[model samples]
Target chain A: MNQTIETMLNHRSVRKFKEENLSPEQIQMIVEAAQMASTSSFIQAYSIIGVTDPEKKKKLAKLAGGQDYVSESGHFFVFCADLYRHSLIGKWENADVDDSIMSMEKFMVSVIDASLAAQNAAVAAESMGLGICYIGGLRNNLPEVSELLETPEHVIPLFGLTVGVPDQKTAVKPRMPFQSIYHENSYRHQKDTVKQEMNEYNEAISAYYHERTAGKRSDKWTEQMAKMLQRKSRMYMKEFVEGKNFAKK
Target chain B: MNQTIETMLNHRSVRKFKEENLSPEQIQMIVEAAQMASTSSFIQAYSIIGVTDPEKKKKLAKLAGGQDYVSESGHFFVFCADLYRHSLIGKWENADVDDSIMSMEKFMVSVIDASLAAQNAAVAAESMGLGICYIGGLRNNLPEVSELLETPEHVIPLFGLTVGVPDQKTAVKPRMPFQSIYHENSYRHQKDTVKQEMNEYNEAISAYYHERTAGKRSDKWTEQMAKMLQRKSRMYMKEFVEGKNFAKK
Candidate 1:
């Protein structure tokens, strides 16, 4: 395999980081890589906010549920699904585009755009021998995070990427089996087939957790997923996205 | 720059492709790379469907608005945001996870997961000297596409990826100015500042279209965006996604 595939195959989220900052050149390279990702309809409905200020990083760390890595990474970037520029374009052309921009399709487009870009940035960082972690914890308080970042309407912060030199290395977490996630020609929607595949995956994951934690924790994938899902986390996301004037339709 | 960054920066969607099918090994490698992408909380809420049957590809090409590449590519993969496995897990564990699964937060997670994995697969294919294009046109008729794929509830087809050997090379389309998309710490929300930046971009894009088409077409970015957004598209996406038992909360 080539270096690119090798880099991807060895991917892992790095939470701990060395006390060092990325050079301006590195950050620019990462952002440039993100820019090259494909955009739906060439809308490029996304933006990257580089958090360099110490105070801002500290605040974001707390806002992200007290994740110290959010403050300690070499550089933290917030990826935003932004349609503000489209709104401006509509205003300049005197076109009523609000109905289109507020539609669920556009919202999905923006989210997909931001996500594809973020993944490219992650790969770019990893290729440069750096470690990266995606901090979904930013969603814990998006309104405050948006206020702190001074984001405008039609710009929703989706997630944060923390890139830095590695302070620790961890094993790549095994994913669900290929049969479970890959279908040929059409979906294998039979429940019994899926259950058998998932049960096998559950055993593998339980073994992984057991080995990692030295028997302290060995939860099956189903048990962990059920527990997490039963809690009903992030119930405010719909209202919050609507508040930002997105997906209102 | 390294080969990985070089691969990303040189990305251009290929519509015209040489008529050659990819080997099974290539497909496996690409999907493996996709699985290596980080998932939100390890949810892995996505699946890839390899469309190989000629009849299926022909129907998909029609479903994707007569995009020839959808049928002509070396291989086409449909990336889907899936929670079917999780729903099954909940059923097995006797846990009430429907509230969480139906939340907007989980919906976003699934979409992001699918997008990230698709991007990784795209990069892997490109690194192997294959051309790749994302077909958002799959959303044109989601119900029919889902029915064709036989996807179960909680599984939404996000988009399709067509990979092949390039028959024609195209220059990379210019993106917005770096300053326009990248902000420092906080978003630069001033309308005038953004307007000025976008105006400069408009000139660049207009010139690009002019030169590329030898003056046959010269549309400014704003004009194109306004025209496209003026027409309401994909009004059925919300109802379709909700019908799939997602984002209903």
Candidate 2:
């Protein structure tokens, strides 16, 4: 396999990072790589905020459910789904129209754009031998994050990224078998593989935990996933979008 | 910069394509790479449906606002924001605890997960000398597309991708000046550079279009964006997300 493909296939999210700093030149190059990512309809509806201040980083870490890496990583950025620029652009020269910019689809384009750019930066950092992690906890307290970032209307803090040299090593956790998620024609229109494939995956993952933790913490994938992850979190996303004037009503 | 970074920076959305099919090995490697992408909290909340039927492809092409490449690429896949597996996991295990699976945050997690996986597939495809185009137009007629795919509730058809050999070559269009979107501390907390940078970008993009199209079209970034793209499209996204039983209420 080629270098690019190899880097992508061997992906990992690193939480513990060494104490080091990225050079300005290196950060510039990474940001340039992010800019090169394709934006939807060329809207370029995203912005990256580099948090260099230790105090701010510390507070951000606390805000993101005390994810220490948010402060510990040598570099951190909050990717915002931004439509303020489009509004600003509308104010200039396009005075006669800007109604479509306020639609739900347009707002989603910004969110997707932010996600795409952040992923590109993640791949770029990993390829450069730097470790990285995404802090979804940024949304653990959404309004506070917006206040902290001082984002204007039409902008929302989608997520934060932490990048640094790795200070810990970890295994790449197994994913569901290829056939389970990637299907021919359609998963629904085709066959029901969930019961069968998931049963097998449960075995593999159960074994994985048993082997990894010496049988100390053996939790099945579905059981643990349902109990842990499928919780009622971020119910205010609707409010968050609406409060920010991104409701596209 | 390294080869991987170069590959990413050189990416282009290929709409035109050579009529060729990808070998099964190539497709497997690409999906493997997609599976390897990092998921939010390892939930892996996404599924990919490869649409190989010419009849289905034709219908999808029409559904996506008549985007010809949806059928022309000879290979197509739809990325679904899936929480169905999580719900099923809840059903089999934590029957009483399925409340959280329907949260808005969980839904956003799935959307972001799907996008991350799709972008990895795009990068992997580009790495192997293949071309890709993301059809957000898949959402142009979202509910119908879902019915056509037979996807159940809590599964939204997020977007579609087309992959094949490139039948056209295009220059990399210019992005906003790096400093405009890449802020040192914050865009709002710091200074507003949008006007200045956009002024320069407008000139750059105007020149790009002028040269590329040989004066057949000349539209500034903000002007064209305001004139053409700012129309209110996909206003039903709010209702669609709410209707999927994935609502965060």
Candidate 3:
């Protein structure tokens, strides 16, 4: 128990990787751990596409805003929110899949299922002295990723995971103060929590970034938020997902 | 390492409790583990509301389809996909939060972040001999869960989690043959994977259900899928979330 909690606490994203790949047994074990994660309604609404082919990895890296780790990692996988198989099962049972599968709630459930499983996979990898980084950049060119991966409708690529031997270490990024996130029996207004700690957190974040980047970047949390929240990214995700039959046809 | 792996593999959702509440220290440790989880772009886009109030728990159990377990656990929490803090930070920085925070991609990021943190918390709890069940039924009536919890705009409840000592054990549910979910190199069509194992899986599920229910229910996986996929549930989620200011004003 102590070891597992320690592993979860000591986690850091590894973007650089050694050339070595994971053994088949390691991949198998990590995947089984992922499978054991609870799915909503036992729907098991997710799929994983492991990409070891160099050509395909290169294609994904380029499509994912040129993240070199996507192509250079020990193993790369695209975790998809998949309802396609359930639809097939519905057909086998002569049921109207559109009625249940097309709602926003189900779509949200699928996202939770996929995300939870991916975290388990990550923890499993970390427990074995391996490192992993999530590649949300994959969303930058979702249409192309869909085309390249041969992903069918109702299975959208949510994010990519790069699992590898760590070639570089990253600082454990500073999180906001505890009170800012942990609420009591009822939700407290921001003034009573996050606002109280905002400046302290901002300074801590600034210091962490300053040391990590050798003083090249020393922006606080709010400064980073300003820049990140100004750009409208993946604006077409709704239409893309809905078009892929995630919505009523 | 092996012990942690085994704990993850042996996971089951325990709905019944032993009438024991966790110590304050244990809950603190679990929440810290959750804070240590990786968030996209360091956004940390999630909030957890711990609900120990009997009235709130009873109200939630009713709103969440009368799952008595919601009100009968050692600890119950509603996890929210929070962009509220980011908007506040944007206001502090004088940036236009509406353009970036309102997009579907950002919404998806928040969902992934919140779900990942919740999974970590679940694992942390399980490592300490506590059993956890995810309460997705919270979405059944989002507005009420929000109202009961006093969750404000830009903060939406995604799911709930119940943690307690296990008083009952459920059968380890069988998953689809892994080839149905895991693909090599790229996505494989259902005809090439899931169909090959569908009938076998259906029979296994039927038998399992028969044994568990003493033949009171002998339905195949296909029959279950038929019933599960015919009802549209929580269709109001999109509008509810958008109303919470997660969408552009």
Candidate 4:
């Protein structure tokens, strides 16, 4: 009911943007808001790269599978799960911290830390009347992205956020029903109930697509998920993350 | 700054809480706000388990290394990186989605999805004059926790969010300087420059602790990090996640 909840509920990803850039003050405020998010055990293991140069943004757009919004956004921020600072601290204090840094626990912490911060940034941008899109397409080619970002060891480019003035309005996509995703105390694994919920959701999604595309396309949620998941994506992610000296324990 | 940004910026982990329960309306609104967060490629691969049973919460507290707040909060929600529903969809649609579900890319997507939603829930709770603390200690015994929750394969509980009324006030912890974590175009890996920034932050943190604890604790940020990382914690996380049918490429 409050403005904060309203902003969150009205969220949508904007792919089309106007040609105006965000003010430096807005950028600073957004990043500051991100910095205020909770960090696991005070290990603020994340960094943000603000891509302002037109040439760099263009290359990034190409890297993100030709998503032009990456180049034309008011600002593009690549959120990286970074532990290079912790590594330096280990060396400074003459402590043997390689095992911890390379452990899967630390990797998960860094990923969660980066994600929590990015959500705060998104909410901050939206609160300021700007639109933002999360660029998971960056993961389509992680090695190239890492090299382009010049990230050092133990620093992985997790995802990007493209923020700009919206040139096109988007409807908020429907999510899974509360009963489908929410459980009380313990997880309920009733297959019949789950199937019933999925059936209803599939119908809802079919109607949504039908209305959105003027009957040209009407795909159920499960149909879309099934089609997309039939093909493997980013299969090298495991090896790549391991090569970066993370989750190696 | 607007109300949403203010809610985000004022976030602090609330471990001590008043013995009060969240109303059904508050819980619904919080979860609805969470459902509105952006999902990667429309894969809403996440689930939330709300623990209202005192016995279950007590067991969870024990599982989280005796973090009593896990049991004392007004409401506790466990965010799980879930691909179980997608797997079910694959079966219903007769699609061979095993390879994709088992890939690291989908695993990362699930984790990111859950984290984003949890952060939104946190913001929503804070905006409503509530408090939240992320319980990462659940990772200490994930297998037992999973068994307790009765979650199926491909559903990994990432973390817990404890929401309640704050019983204690905590100061906002100082973070690393903006220059320390923000890069312009490319990631700045200047060792000397980073060292200088770390030195200044260490001084600030030392002073903060000195003032907060009345000289009882005056540890620098780097010192605390080095000491913490020197200990090998949660070494079994890699094998645990793999055993739970995730991140297995």
Compare the candidates by DockQ and give the number of the best one.
1
DockQ of each: 0.90, 0.63, 0.72, 0.88
RMSD of each candidate relative to the true structure:
0.9, 1.9, 1.7, 0.9
lDDT of 3 at A150: 92
- Per-residue CA lDDT of model 1 for A1-249, tens digit only, reads 999999999999999999999999999999999999999999899999999999999999999899999999999999999999899888899999999899899999999999999999999999999999999999989999999999999999999999999999798899888878889999998889988887898899999999999999888888889988999888999999988888888
Interface RMSD of 4: 0.8
| True contacts reproduced, candidate 2 | 0.69
In order, the candidates keep a fraction of the true contacts of: 0.92, 0.69, 0.79, 0.89
Task: Pick the lDDT winner.
Answer: 1
What is the per-residue lDDT of model 1 for residues B115-204, given as tens digits with 9 covering 90 to 100?
Answer: 999999999999999999999999999999999999999999999999999999899999888888899999998989988998899899
Off by over 4 Å in 3: A213-216, A247-249, B190-193, B247-249
Indicate the residue-level lDDT of B90 in model 4: 88
Give the lowest summed-lDDT range of ten residues in model 4 chain A: A185-194
What TM-score do all the candidates reach, one by one?
0.99, 0.95, 0.96, 0.99
List, residue by residue over A207-247, the lDDT tens digit for candidate 3: 88888888998898888888988877778877787787764
Model 1 CA deviation exceeding 4 Å by range: none
